[model samples]
Target: MSEARNTFGKTSITQKSKKLQPRVDLTAMVSVSFLLIVFFMLSSFLSRSNAMDFGMPDKRHIDCGTEPYCLGEDRLYTVLVGINKIVCYEGNRLDFSNETRSFKFNDNLLIKEMISKNQFLKNFYGDKKGLIVIIKPSKESNYGNLVDVLDEMAIVKVPTYAVVDITPEEEKLLADK
Candidate 1:
């Protein structure tokens, strides 16, 4: 709200028009501003994205009385994530001779490789649950790299995958490269 008012002054022979000061009431504006702020805050908070559900391996060891649970070497795949490059191999050991292959994040080579390997494993094992992927992220890698690898696993439709800590030997290998 706004208004103008005139004040009385001494009278003189020459008459002059007096200037009035304008007054504005801001109570309604303040209230509306606060309401808008609260509405936006609540809306943003309510619409926030939920965290992704990630499964972690259980630490407790299960005992098989007479039999040992073992996964075949060919079924296991290891992926090591570094700064901008990814190193992958089949089985637990990182063999530089012929098994290890490195890829960059910008390309689709890694995804294609994983899909082919997964398909091969499925056909060779004659079962849907044959491939097991183990992801090991190095210290130089960022969180986005890990998440990208996880996304790759999902894209490849891998049934079983675990995010494990990188071994010292593996770290040394990466450093030497």
Candidate 2:
């Protein structure tokens, strides 16, 4: 816009306002922002589910005719994976005769216990086949605990371990404790 002096030093006529383009170009900014968004979207890692190097037990040997599960009570060890704790015993049932041991989540006590048990069995029976383990996790047990217990089995080189449901008697035993 411009001002023109009319008569007595007074401004009267003026040019129309010119539309000046913005000096800062936002094209670079928009492109940079889009590139950043794309970078993050592509670089971010998606959470993938993982499992132990264990497979389903063979159905061939699960033929304890009358019983719901495999029998061989003497070789079977029961591990009850509870909330932040493991209640374990070496037998089919959590009974009076068999002693039970409980370990916390921290310090890897469960692993140690399993290792000791394995050593004991190896020394006593002089065979790895005798240590059959049945793992039962309560609803309170988390996925990590289950994985830890399974990992401990691998660490102890346990030949036979089965993840199973807790019987009513076993649940009652846990409730009592």
Candidate 3:
């Protein structure tokens, strides 16, 4: 004879059958993934469209570099654009006492002077490419002032430019002057 078995809960051991329910709420997951995709697309677009702005000189490639590795060579005339004053330096030295002294950016005369001087430099050097303006702002200068100087440089159509900070050596030289 067959034997009867007892189960934890139910009418009888073999009376009820077990059933499994399939579960999958994919709607929330799909919504989240879609939102993530949209967010990333927008973020990437914004980042790609942002302007590439640089501040200060890139010391690694240009500043403190050696020989031909340094920025602004003999082929380019170097113009120093400072917030309070714009001075021109050549051969990495500013000699005010020399007969060929530096020019200051003041009123409209400075721009005119720059044009004539740049013309002379281009004629002599045979590189009419454009001037190389090195922008240096004094520590006490405001950002707006620096921007104004940059605007003037832009108006003059500088080919390319770099920024230089007043190093301890440069400051001492200026102080001695």
Q: Which candidate is the best by lDDT?
A: 1
Candidate RMSDs in order: 10.1, 9.2, 6.8
Q: Write the per-residue lDDT of candidate 2 for residues 1-177, one digit (tens) a residue.
A: 899656787655996699998799799999999999988887674443454666665556454576646566767789988887878887876668988877787867777777777777788888745477889988778889998888888888897888877777777666566
TM-score of each: 0.64, 0.60, 0.50
Give model 3's TM-score versus the native structure.
0.50
User: Which parts of model 3 are misplaced by more than 4 Å?
Assistant: 1-20, 47-92, 97-128, 151-157, 167-177
Q: How high is the lDDT of residue 81 in model 3?
A: 44
Candidate 3: 10-residue stretch with minimal lDDT: 97-106
Of 2 and 3, which scores higher on TM-score? 2
Greater-lDDT candidate between 2 and 3:
2
In model 3, the Cα lDDT at residue 126 comes to 74
- Per-residue CA lDDT of model 3 for 1-177, tens digit only, reads 999787556665465567879899899999999999999999998888543244565566443635533644543444444445544445444445422224444566556655665666678767755566566566655676667666665566555666677655444443333
Error of 3 at 71 (Å): 8.2
Candidate 1 deviant stretches above 4 angstroms? 1-51, 60-69, 95-98
Question: Residue-wise lDDT of candidate 1 within 1-177, one digit each (tens)?
Answer: 788555567456778788889889999999999999999999999998886557776666445663222566678888889999888888876655536778889989988988888888888877766678889999999999999999988888888998888989888766665
Task: State residue 146's C-alpha deviation in candidate 2, in Å.
Answer: 0.4
Q: Rate the local accuracy (lDDT) of all candidates.
A: 0.82, 0.77, 0.57
